[model samples]
Target: MDELMRRRVYGADHDDPDPGPRPGHVYVELVGGPLDGLLLDITGWPQDRLAVGAALGTELGKFGPGGRAVYGPTAAGPGRWAWEADSP
Candidate 1:
């Protein structure tokens, strides 16, 4: 998990047909591990990309397979953000 966080996590917009341009939505997916393929959605975040990624990483550190976590939007606005544990 430490290694994963150290590496750059790729992100894309929800509506993007191609992996280009920044969108309001962002997500980080685990490549391999017990939580392999798990996706953490940070779309509702109104902060910069770095902040969103940090939040996602912090949440992920406390998460495990079969576990879940949800975050409410920051002062940015109102929206529900969630991290889902994908079934292996």
Candidate 2:
């Protein structure tokens, strides 16, 4: 195995198309309320798995494998955002 295969950011439940990290499109997270929109520049990511994994590590605050989700106040943005997996 290589360094790229070592990173696993996707949940066993998420099965969307492989939108590589720094994907051209911004990921949106709308909770509690809505806004005109919050955009974060993700142009620095790659169009492959390596980029996606790195991005996940940056957001999750670590570079391991699996962990539970932790949620903070509601925040909408263009970049990547994470919340408790059970958050509503």
Candidate 3:
């Protein structure tokens, strides 16, 4: 959102979209491996699924066609999931 519009709708102090976790929505930061520094929105995902982490499929993977970027929750911090491995 533009600064003027943001100031009008979300107050002057709010310059950008809120990145904090909300009910039914969570944003995680990918910490390492190929897709580092990516912010993922994990809304509507089951708690169990989030706990175990996920194998996110990507076309830009090292293995190309059939690669999956595996990520898992870590003790690093809140909303931080580290790269576990890559699958082909």
User: What C-alpha lDDT do the candidate models reach, one value each?
Assistant: 0.39, 0.31, 0.66
TM-scores, one per candidate: 0.25, 0.19, 0.66
Per-residue CA lDDT of model 1 for 1-88, tens digit only, reads 4433333323344464554323454555543333344444555645765344332323233455433333323444332233332222
Model 3 lDDT per residue over 1-88, tens place: 1321212210112354653333454567777877676656677788998899878776556777678888889998857899988889
Weakest 10 consecutive residues, lDDT, candidate 3? 4-13
After the best TM-score superposition of candidate 3, give how far the Cα of residue 43 lies from its true spot, in angstroms. Answer: 1.1
The candidate scoring highest on lDDT is 3
The best candidate in terms of TM-score: 3
Model 3 misplaced regions, further than 4 Å: 1-24
Candidate 2 per-residue lDDT, tens place, 56-80, comes to 2123323234433333233343333
Predictions: Cα RMSD each: 11.0, 13.7, 8.9
Question: Which candidate order results from sorting by TM-score in descending order?
Answer: 3, 1, 2
Sorting all predicted structures by lDDT, with the top scorer first, yields 3, 1, 2
**Which residue pairs does candidate 2 place in steric collision?**
22-45
Candidate 2: which stretches are off by over 4 Å?
1-36, 49-88
User: Runs in model 1 with CA error above 4 Å?
Assistant: 1-24, 46-88
Clashes of each: 0, 1, 0
